[model samples]
Target: MQPTELMVCTQHAPPIGGAFVVPAPPLPLVPHALKPEILMEAIALLATAVPLALVVALLCATVVCLAAICRAHRTDVVAVVQALPDLALALLRRRRP
Candidate 1:
């Protein structure tokens, strides 16, 4: 092939010492601030959501603590559960007496 033909075939050959102009990418869309009503809605949502989250967190902590206590006294808890029926009967007998 001729040199010019080879140069034309070479995909990456830069224009002979000529500056290449790359167009700048289009600017991204800028986000506008929330309207006052939307901002207040968000605040009100957060106010309710925060307390609900705290309540759920507290319940979860309570469950975890109770589980830990049960685990720590596994045998005792089982014994008490097993004795509940007898204890109820004994309480009934005592009340009658």
Candidate 2:
């Protein structure tokens, strides 16, 4: 084929390896019966509800972690609390060497 003929053939061919592609149909439009105010209210509710739910979940997680830590160190905490009075008395009774 002449170069001019080859160029004319390719000019009408698909860009990708000559594969034919069908154009996608456009999306359907929303019905006129759907109110914009209802959509906006739903969006607003989601905006506030999502963050509020996240904060509550975070707070619940924090409380669970703290409870676990305290449970794990319960004996150590009790021992320190019980020793406070003796430690104070010992400090008061210490004399210069």
lDDT by residue (30-61, candidate 2, tens digit) is 75436798788889999999999999999999
- What value of lDDT does candidate 1 attain over all alpha carbons? 0.73
Q: Could you report the Cα RMSD, in angstroms, for every candidate shown?
A: 15.8, 14.4
Question: How displaced is residue 68 in candidate 2, in Å?
Answer: 0.3
* TM agreement with the true structure for every prediction: 0.42, 0.41
Give the TM-score (vs. native) of candidate 1.
0.42
- What would the per-residue lDDT of candidate 1 be over residues 1-97, giving only the tens digit for each residue? 2244334342454455563334455565753336677788889999999999999999999999798766777798788789999999999999995
Clashing pairs in 2: none
Candidate 2 regions exceeding 4 Å error are: 1-33, 73-97
